[model samples]
Target: MQNSNLNLARKWRSKNFDQIIGQDLVVRILKNSLYLNQFFPVYLFSGQRGCGKTSTARIFATALNCEKLAEFQKNPKTEFPCFQCASCIAMQNSKHPDFIEMDAASHTGVDNVRNIIEFSTLMPVLGKKKIYLIDEAHMLSKAAFNAFLKILEEPPISVIFILATTDVEKIIDTVRSRCFQLIFSALPNDSLVDHLSKICEKENIEFERDGLELIVNESEGSARDAINLMEQVRFSAEKITKSNVQKNLGHPDDEKILMLFAKLSQKVEISNLLGYLSEISFYELSATFIWGQILKLSRVAIYLKYGVIFRTNFDLEKISEIIKIVNVKHLINVMEIFCNYEQVFAKTSNKNILLETLFFKILDHSNKIEVKTSSLIKEPEKKSSETVPWATFLQKVEALNDPLVFSVFKRAKFINAESDKVIISFFKNYEFLLSILNDTRTVWSLILEEIFKTKNLETQIVEKEKVIEQPKADIEVEIHKAEPVLEPLKKNFKSFQNSKVDVSDKDKWKLANYLLESFPGDLIEVKE
Candidate 1:
């Protein structure tokens, strides 16, 4: 017995080439091949799931084995199977002996390939040709593919292998090259809507056009998903409505999403929004959906700004208002922030808190911009006679032509500035910078004096003392004994060598001779 809940997808499954919807091109090509009596030993069908790959394979098989096809071949006009024939009925019921279907997902081993190879050697018991339909062929193991490659290259005269996969990139190049490739595309929204409407009328089911549109939008171009969604909605209520569709699909409320966007644009307080958000469950999903809507509207606004009249279902006046308030760069920033944190939000256990934090961060950024703009408008006028402060002088230094001098000067603090002198100090860690600035003080003082309209402007550095503690008495005695005994003679030799020497006054001439021998070149000038 079959399940009482009838599957509309299976009940209305396409049985022949002419009956398949949204795939006229594939049907025409197959019909042309049938008319010419030319067929490939292997056929590869690649497409998204439920786009009629397997169904087309079965229809092609039926045409190949149909007893009525020979009669039609003589007529040269009909290219499809007569479904009333015994072979057609058997194929439709999936009871034909020669029509073998293998799901490579479950049977993804060399053993399965071996069984297939073994089966290909025999004659068809019922049909004219032994047809092998391997679905999800990409899931086959490399070893299994290697085992199947040889037989696929040269199958028996009466055998045809049809491979179908959603991911053709996963199939090895060797296997892909040996077959006739046919690509199926996702059904367009219009085609899907028309198909769903026909199904509803045939099944005597009640439906609204907008309700079906919602289903199409959620289907993302997959026909199977659209039908399944329609079936779910059909059984949930007496008549399908947009509200019921949203409820069954767990889609965010459209009105609430729009209201939130409105509040965001109007600069509503974050606390108020949080109160509203707390009342709604699935805030994370709602936020994600709102982000998508904003991104879409942003794109439309950009196109409109560029004078491109893009067709959209959104309210034009509302979009115009949004464009007036939000610039493209800000929209891009919003998108980037949301996208970067999307994965974090998905992995986080405290999604509500994370969502609240995200909203507040965006709000804070907006408020900061508003405050900065207001401050700029309210700034007081400056007097030309007054001298610039040290902070303003630093800004002028930053704009100097010589970056090296300015780089050193920017790190020092201005201690005092008088008519003829300017004093600067450096922290202990920045003493090296102070030393470098002091070495170039003459040039910098001239530049500063010219800028300040004062003569003899002397820039000074104030260095802090670095104290060193003395060693203990015992360690000092060891240090004194370790020095050379002839201190006066070592000092005289040190003066001659121009190098430091410590001694306790003993045999300094020997040390001087050793230094001279070690550095003989030091006695003469060497030119490159």
Candidate 2:
């Protein structure tokens, strides 16, 4: 495959207003405003990257300069520049005498802006009007902004200023007010998917409908990103399916996550957890997204517990394991643990530690999980068959309000609770467990108490075994967390009695007032 043909972005860039796939409202407004006796001198186009903000600006400029505007409208050649014309060619080549594009980020100093203003005063050498388009105008410095204020407020009749920026807030209110602002919206999922399908057809690549849908879901509305991912997929193979898409894109193939989740649904055990972890060890799924996938499975188990009747991407074996040990409330508890630990996902270095800590903590807290069981000693035998409440307790300590805690639990193969103990199982202990346990001083005892309390019962954690003590030489260095380290804060002294710095008249007056207010002191007059 040719390298030039590989990048779909370069081939698919919209050259005309009609070629622009999205932004119907924007196109309508721009078309209506153009060719009128009244011209907008200053225009602001703002939106996210790869959403056609720059492309729209270029097309609009071309449409204004198109020679065949009337003739093309009658014959309908195109809704934008007649590319064959001299003006359109110049604009396309960026050599148009009337059009000048500037990157404000690179030249946002006062001197650079002053030169632009000087150039703006010159008359248009060709075309109807001279247009000054500044990209990323938010980067302009305060001095540069102030320098442009005069021209922006009173540009000549033949000059038009087009300012573009991703962050509109950074632009001064005065500059914003002087322009016609247009806000661009993200491309809808349906539109993005449709476009992807078309691109695949054009590229002569085969991909499953589900595979393309995954790309759309993962792209998060950035069409450019979707294309880039597609390029990666194409680069990897001559053909693409949902499975291959998952492998190429490094997505959490719900199947693999489902397998892990299914194992978790089984009774909590080390062997089962390790097996699940080993099954899908490739692609080195980022700790954060891996945690997120587990979070989703936990939610699914809750759905089943509630009899919500939702379908899952996970296979039957995975769901079967979930049915074994998973319950609605337990699922919620698992989610809560992972959710708390997720907050520090960006900062933590060792994802494995965080991941391990999560699993250990879940095991420690999941001692007494509640299920839909009516046969409790308190409840009748009839209620026991409907649902049952179980507890899972372990020997390890846990964090109460950490995201990693919930994530490990979310990915838990199983959580079982004894009357006073909780056990948490994880698919594989990696970054998720280690970081959650070692970092983020999140305490789990409180969470255990809360989870138990929700079931109308009380629970407490006690160390399962007693350790034998032996006399040995201890380390010399001591680190005390509670001790006040500051020298001045070491004591409750009222004042520095031995201080040598002389107080000024103002200081003395303030001190005198404070003493008077605090202790009712009165100054005595000095006799000469």
Candidate 3:
């Protein structure tokens, strides 16, 4: 009978280098080093979590101290340590005095380093080599790392150090230079699937192929995460099904996500689309989850467009339908819109409304692209337009050789420029420009008219009143009529607000301009 209390990740941890998954290069190098009897004073292991750095370190330590090393070396096919030696048994049971494992996250001070250094000086008590494995070694403080420098530079021959970290760059260069480095990678989906499959069979857990694959996807290449998820799904049902996995994990069904995109690509009405979205439970799926789905769908569509098919469980037919209505550029635009609003999606509590807003925004972006009706065909890419020079209106005003108009107009900030209109903002201090243009509307109109003859652009001026709202003056100020110093603070706050809006508005214009340039004749509108 299987142990009900033990988690699959811990129970199935690799016991030997041969049992390690998806680290062929590392295993090979370590095995060769062992066979050749070449041992380094220190070794650095770096990779994402659950990629078998610590497990390999333990197995290597066992092999280094195994009593039957000569016998095992004679048989090239035999796995490391033979798993029968007294030292190997001691290591397995965590009873080996020579093998020490320290979590650097908990012991990050120089005192910890001093203790470790003192321990390194001691000769092996129960084995040939005294090995120290420090996991998350990047968490060590600067002083602790500096304390490690001397010992790392000239460590005892009988002692070996194995430092493992998810982030290798955080380690000091001096300490890193003293060690031999090995880089581990997250296991591939196929590797993780195969590993999980064996574990399921060994444990007598039943699962559907698709359901297991879903677990692998959720694990994001972490073997431990995949096994833990598999164990969770096992507890949910006797035989894992796609629906069971989705329901238990609260994952929006892939079919539903695919259909949502299909309807979106067709530019269905917002109300109807929102209803479709409600059926999927936007709160459960969440805006961030849906946004991730959109990115994945976009990638699949792009790959399909280029005739490059990948191993994907997403309904290819549904994705194909999306690719037919929306081309690669349209998909990219959708992804870009999601990318820009990702933070908003993550922070907003009203996700239903936020996602609904994105739906409309995506539809609006797609409508600008002229998609081909036929299957497997894309519209020809339009040639890019030359970069438009900024403040062309000011250039036109300057050309008129009117110093007063030029000087006043030069200070005006360009709010926006479109084929139909050009909007500029003037502060209250520049009210004279508005009055001057108002007095001579014909002269002002002629300059813009000549500049945008092709666009037929009309000019609009926005005046900013420097009216600042200050907190009700303090009681003392009101009683004594003391000069309040809050005027500058209020101005600064208002300037910050205006500057923030200006940046957001600037991005909208850039996107609109890109669409106009890409599609040539499309009427790309920018809405507030």
Candidate 4:
């Protein structure tokens, strides 16, 4: 979108009431107000930069001052200058005597504002109505604003004042109370894209639809920003494409970050991950892009364990080993690290320091094990069938509505209740179980004692953790419900293909309730 020689955003800029984009409602309201002669002076049009606040105000002034719609439409020359007329040309060029435009930003002093008020005593030189268009009017000094307030409250019938600002809150309450307020919102993407495409076509600038989509996405719903970005890109290149937008935006070289994330996820060595991350200069990456890449990779790893689709941009060779080495929860923790760092990166100027700190944090925590009990990070073995005190303890613990703790634990299967009071095991896989218990000690105790009914309970997380040494489909310390419960577990647990728990009423009730509370589920039960 490189139009360096001239501003394309201005080339296709809106003119006339009919030309505005993505603000139909606001336009309609203003038009109706004008047509109905419901003139409320002291208007405030507020929103972000480049949303056309000044343009709309100027045009509204033109329409208001125009002598005749019928005669102007026919011959088209009045004091208001119908754009086709000399008067209109002067107005467009900001030379019109009756149409006074002021910048409160620069003339914010009391004297500058007092001058406008002093001049208001004189009537318009020519036009039927004199319109004062104030841009960024919020910059007016408090004394200046107070001076203008007297005039604004009971100005001569000929004067129409329009105050424009991006910050409505800055305008004093007295000024606001006298004016009609129009809130201009950021343009929507679909609307922004359609307008961009039409403008590009009309201007003869070549733009790819996908590339246009990227620009629109980058604009974040600001129509002006979309056009500005378009101009910047179109100015430098002959044609605007997705890659071009990606290059200038520094939007995280998505493919590269995805590749690195995929590699780290696959158990790529800490040193190697660091080396790869270092190759992509920190400045080349944006916090948002990093966050998105890390989150996606972590989600994919979690999805893989759950038998859900792990859609990824990276090659299989890059991620397969990491997924084998690191469990889902730890991967999730790593993602959180990046997401937090992204926020920090966005706000601070000390980017290199912040990024380096974040890199080390991730690298350090990369070895974080989910198991709470031991140093070894190994998967678990199937548990023994023999009924253990801890088995009863788990049932009581699982029954509580300790929401957040239960929310995470619900992801685990009821692998086996340990025989000893000192330690508990779950997650059928030894490595996975160990990772949880080791990494989350406080949660481990709270989850076991508060939920499991064993306050003295300690945890031991084992690696390559042992198998559930039990007979197939055996039940331990089952809690029969007071009322018959529906079989939600049988109905919806295809992800737990390796699960050996019975789908009986109580089991179903417990699973269903947990699912309902932990995951947003559509599960229903008919106890009757």
Q: Which stretches of candidate 1 lie over 4 Å from their true place?
A: 1-5, 68-79, 265-267, 282-294, 297-317, 345-353, 366-528
lDDT string for model 1 (1-116, tens) is: 25245598887777787678788888888888887788999999999988999989999999999887777667756656987778888887779999999999999999999999
Looking at candidate 4, the ten consecutive residues that score lowest on lDDT are: 494-503
Q: Per-residue CA lDDT of candidate 2, range 1-528, in tens?
A: 353653787677778887676799998788766644356888999987778788888888877767877765565435456688888989877789888889998988999888888888899876777888899999999889888888888899888888888899999988888889998887787888888899889878887877777777677777888888877888897766678778876676776777665554443675556556666673366666677677877776777666565554445345645566566565676787787677676578988568756765555544554455432224543533212322232123223333444544444433355566545444332323434443322455444555543322222233334554434443233556796566654665464334233334644464444345545645664433
Q: Which stretches of candidate 3 lie over 4 Å from their true place?
A: 1-5, 343-353, 365-528
Can you write out model 4's per-residue Cα lDDT over 372-473, one digit (the tens) per residue? 543234557655654344456455546665443454444444434433444343444433334434444565576566444554544334354455555535
Per-residue error at 462 for model 1, in Å?
Answer: 7.9
RMSD per candidate (Å) reads 12.4, 21.1, 17.3, 20.0
Pairs clashing within candidate 3: none
Candidate No. with top lDDT: 3
| Stretches > 4 Å off in candidate 4 | 1-6, 70-82, 250-252, 264-267, 283-335, 338-348, 363-528
Superposition TM-score, candidate 1 onto the true structure = 0.68
Q: Estimate each model's TM-score.
A: 0.68, 0.62, 0.68, 0.61
lDDT on C-alpha atoms for all candidate structures: 0.75, 0.68, 0.79, 0.69
Candidate 1 worst ten-residue window by lDDT: 367-376
